[model samples]
Target: MRSRYTAYVLGLEDYLLQTWHPDFRPVSLDLAENEQIKWLGLRVNQTALTSENTASVDFIARYKIRGKAERMHELSQFELIENHWYYLTGEMK
Candidate 1:
């Protein structure tokens, strides 16, 4: 999660795409010319075991970009694939 966050801050779009789940991957990303997103911090609210191979991580990612403040609070789903956690999707909170 943190690595992906840094990828966004550093304008590493390819890294972000690589980490995303296959089904949820975006076809393109218009990265900002100037890296303006100020990463405040991440607050991991909770984790729930949905099944033996699934889990949900609730978190708040705060930042400021393009002279505006934004916070993405999401309940993100993760699946254990090939002994690694793969991000699937999320419900915005």
Candidate 2:
């Protein structure tokens, strides 16, 4: 999860897509389109095991765009496949 946040901060779209579950991944993503956004930090609020190979993480991320600060709070779901974690989906708060 933290690595995914770091990928966003660095605008690493390829890494982001690679880590996402194929079923949930979009056909394409362009991080450069949001270049105006300056990521500040990410705070993991909580994590819970939902199933043997599934988990949920609640997090808050801060960013600024044109000097306007904003926060994104989300509950994300992930699945463990072949000893690797893959992002499924997220619900924004």
Candidate 3:
């Protein structure tokens, strides 16, 4: 989760895509379109292992866009496949 947050902060779209589960990955995030966005920080509220190969992370990310401060709170799900973890999906909170 922290790595993904750093990916967004660095606008590393390719890296983000690589870590996302294919079933839920988008064709493009268009990070360049949001170049004005300034990421403040990330706070991981909690994490839990739902199963042997599945887990969830709840976090809050603070940022600024168009000079307006904002935050995103999400409960992100992940799956372990072939010894690698992939982001599966997330729910806005």
Candidate 4:
């Protein structure tokens, strides 16, 4: 999860897509204006795993855009496939 967050902070769209579940993968990722998005930090709020292959992590990411501050709380899901973790989906928390 931290790796994914690092990818996000660095605006590494390729890495993000590579780690995403194919079933939920998008056709493309466009970070055309990512330079304007400032990611401050991420805080893990909660984590739960029902088995060795699946898990959910709730996190709050702080950021700023234009002149306003914002925080996004999202519950992200992950699935382990062939011993590799893949991001499945997420819902706003």
Candidate 5:
């Protein structure tokens, strides 16, 4: 979860895509268009293993865009496949 946050902070769209599950991965995030967004920080509230290969992370990411502050609170889901973890989906909180 932290790594993914860093990816967004750095505008590493390719890296983000690479870590996302193929079934859930979008074709593009268009991070370049969000250049004006300034990522402030990420706070991981909790994490839980739902199953042997599935887990969820509850986090909040703070940022600013056009001098306006905002935050995203999400319960992110992940799946472990072939010893690697991939982001599956997320639900806004």
Candidate 6:
């Protein structure tokens, strides 16, 4: 989750796509187009294993767009495949 946050802050779209589960990966990303977005910080609230190969992370990411502050709270799901963890989906709160 932290790595993914860093990826967003760095505009590392390819790294983000690589970490996402292939089945859930988006066709494309427009990170560079959002030039006004400024990532502030990431706060991980909790993490839990739902099963042997599945887990969830609850986090809050703070940022600013066009000089206006905002935050995103989400519970993200991930699955372990072939000993590697890949992001599956997320639910915004």
Best by TM-score: 2
Q: Give candidate 2's error at residue 44 in angstroms.
A: 0.1
Regions of model 5 farther than 4 Å from truth: none
Better of 1 and 5 by TM-score: 5
| Better structure of 1 and 4 per lDDT | 4
By TM-score, how accurate is candidate 2?
0.97
Give all candidates' CA lDDT scores: 0.83, 0.95, 0.94, 0.90, 0.95, 0.95
Predicted candidate 5 versus true structure: per-residue lDDT over 1-93, tens digit per residue = 899899998989999999999999999899887799999999999999999999999999999999999999999999999998999999999
C-alpha lDDT of residue 41 in model 1: 79
Q: After superposition, how far is residue 18 of candidate 6 from its true place, in Å?
A: 0.6
Q: What TM-scores do the predictions have?
A: 0.81, 0.97, 0.95, 0.93, 0.96, 0.95
State the TM-score for model 6: 0.95
C-alpha positional error of residue 55 in candidate 3 after TM-score superposition, expressed in Å: 0.4
Question: Comparing candidate 4 with candidate 5, which one achieves the higher TM-score?
Answer: 5
The ten-residue window of minimal lDDT in model 1 covers: 28-37
Q: How would you encode candidate 3's per-residue C-alpha lDDT over 16-93 as one tens digit per residue?
A: 999999999999899987689999999999999999999999999999999899999999999999998899999999
For candidate 3, the TM-score is 0.95
lDDT of 2 at 83: 94
**Sort by TM-score, best first: what order?**
2, 5, 6, 3, 4, 1
Pairs that clash in candidate 3: none
Candidate closer to the true structure by lDDT (higher is better), 1 or 3: 3
